[model samples]
Target: MPALSPTMEEGNIVKWLKKEGDTVNVGDALCEIETDKAVVTMESSDEGILAKILVEEGSKNVRLGSLIGLLVEEGQDWKQVEIPADVGVPSSVASPTPAPTPAAPSVSAPPKLQHQPGKLQVRLSPAARNILETHGLDPSNVTPTGPRGIFTKEDALKLLQEKQKGKPSELKPVVSPAPAAVPSPSQATAVTSYSRPAIPPISTPGQPAAVGTFTEIPASNIRRVIAKRLTESKTTIPHAYAAADCAIDAVLKLRKELAKDDIKVSVNDFIIKATAVTLKQMPDVNVTWDGEACRRLQSIDISIAVATDRGLITPIIKDAAAKGIKEIAASAKALAKKARDGKLLPEEYQGGSFSISNLGMFGISGFTAVINPPQACILAVGRARPELRVVEDEEGNEKLEQHQLMTVTLSSDGRVVDDELASKFLETLKANIENPMRLALN
Candidate 1:
């Protein structure tokens, strides 16, 4: 499978787009693959009738070039070929999975000739070498640290990880010092924080910046995928951004009313409902563009981009416009928990009709987002802040107005959504957020 992002080591098939016995044209979507970075539809490379599906759905940690299934040209014979799991694999491409009952390894015949050996050296796989290269290490430079005279994949990876140590590996221009002149125990008393850094903390109390030496971590599979896709979108697709200020006073009041007694709904939950109602009001905003054709989606499965330890993940609230605030909140919580635990199956993150990304919690004031592929648009919700302006009073007296204003930026693929359509969609969203009661009917 072609990598959607650099950090992807494997992708799990979410759903087979074309069922067995289905004819597939070149470039037809064969299945949906969930990589570390995102869930994407993987297309077939060859035109043929799908002969077999080897990998089961919901399988985890699948690798590239591993047999997903068989695709033979139409009219091929139906019998006698044993499609071994190891077929099409180079001897060098290490198997990601091991058989439960592994056969006895081939016996190495004892050397008839005399042998003289000191250190056992091993060979590292190309994949291992790539990992090393990514860490700015040369294979020839490091001594093999594995057992036997071979450099196994695990050994190479372990060595690389040790070298990285959560920090970007920097090749020393030259060895700074020899292994000498070490300090004594008394001279090496442990000290934690430096005195000067505690003087002024940033306004956000809990958020802390790095002090002293710091490490820049390598992106995980999901993050790498996000980067690549976003880069591709920004470079390949022309994007036009439209934003409108949404008054959240009504929304805040509605959420408080909903939260009375046993019922509880957050501001975010309110936003989710408002967005769904707005999406239904302007159907074009819920559409995905497939280059030549724009597919209008029937359901509003709104995917909320959630933060996780491994990377940013999005979990959908299916038919969100029809769900109550409590249900959405529960779904959001469950999905977030699953995502954080890395227990989300591929299907859990797939099939989002539209997406919403909020930076409100982080106090960000309006930023454009990269559109997820096949998706027509994404809404970037900003934080609410107090704003003041002059207004005509009911008695005709000029008055200074104080209000809660939040900015919502809608980024759409120019190829599908024209400027006028995008504007109207934004207006609808603004109205929904401003008139919170209208969203409650859902």
Candidate 2:
């Protein structure tokens, strides 16, 4: 899978672009991978005669670079390639020779997802929509803060509030109501007036009552797991947050230059890149508290957070610091596509040296994220905004200037990451982002 994302030790096949008997050439898209950050697609880096598939659709996660399937050179008999015993996929999914093959594809496939596109469905309240329209805002750009992606009035109201207060969204709000039971229309049986509680003539008011029936959809295995882990993370992680204002002028300048080709890259991409570099610089931050010992790692594979229909998922952007900007963009795209498709295996979503959650594109300026433990640090990014700064003129007169400012938060495990390490990492990340060319130069 080209180690599409950092946390992706493996990826689950949401769907196979090439089926059994399907011919796959070098650079052909094999499948979309759900990495921690987004759904990115993987290509056949090598020319292959696609001998087998490891896991089928709806399968849990799989390891990256593991034989999710094979890409054999042309004219080679697939059966001749001995399959490893550790390739956990069923033989049927792995070797499809004995299985009935599907019809050959009608056309040659195009390159897989260059970058996974995010779905922005906002169900805004009518009032919120009006405010957004009044501000010449496009709700499409603001992620919905409602159920199943329905933007609510509160979301728009809050967004507007932030804009007016000389602030952007500094806090990534998890506006979850008290865990109410599933919404169900009540089936009621009416009671007669005679059965109602009696009242004096002067006090006479309401009478009858009714009882209703409902069926509830309990929390799924995923939801339950989320509840347990998040709660545990909060309860035990001993998290301490240190936030810093970051200058994104250089990064923004580069992004605008890059977007000219209609090749859109979000600010979060730099956030991802910065987080990866920071992890590399402070390898101690790339560790997990194993309850007994602090386990620091040599390699930094940071998982980027992507929200999915199922819930919050963190797909990895593996070895992010090493990849070029174009490659990072491409990998992020493919990872996102696979994530939404729910094809992620356990490995794709789990294991990370660090986590980066960004709400900057959504106009958020700062926020603290809960600890994603065993990993010592989780970085949160807020939106970029114009800030007034005093600068000296050539005449030595003070002048006010506007700068694009962003806030980056590093939530670290109190047990290991001291304030000095966290602060230095944040500063370096800020410097790198502000001078994004450093990344290119390096």
Cα RMSDs, all models: 14.3, 20.8
Residue pairs clashing in model 1 are 36-222, 37-222, 121-149, 122-149, 122-150, 122-151, 123-151
Question: What are the per-residue Cα lDDT tens digits for candidate 2 across 192-304?
Answer: 23554532221111533333423334443345556777999999988888998988888888899988977677777777877777677767778888999988887678788
TM-score for each predicted model, relative to the true structure: 0.58, 0.53
Q: Highest TM-score: which candidate?
A: 1
| Candidate 2 Cα RMSD after full superposition onto the native fold (Å) | 20.8
Task: Quote the positional error of residue 114 for candidate 1 in Å.
Answer: 36
Q: Candidate 1 on 183-230: residue-level lDDT in tens?
A: 678766763435544322112224456454333354545776778878
Q: How well does model 2 score by local distance difference test?
A: 0.69
Q: Distance (Å) between predicted and true CA of 115, model 1?
A: 34
Q: For each candidate, what is the lDDT?
A: 0.72, 0.69
Which portions of model 1 miss their true places by more than 4 Å? 1-218
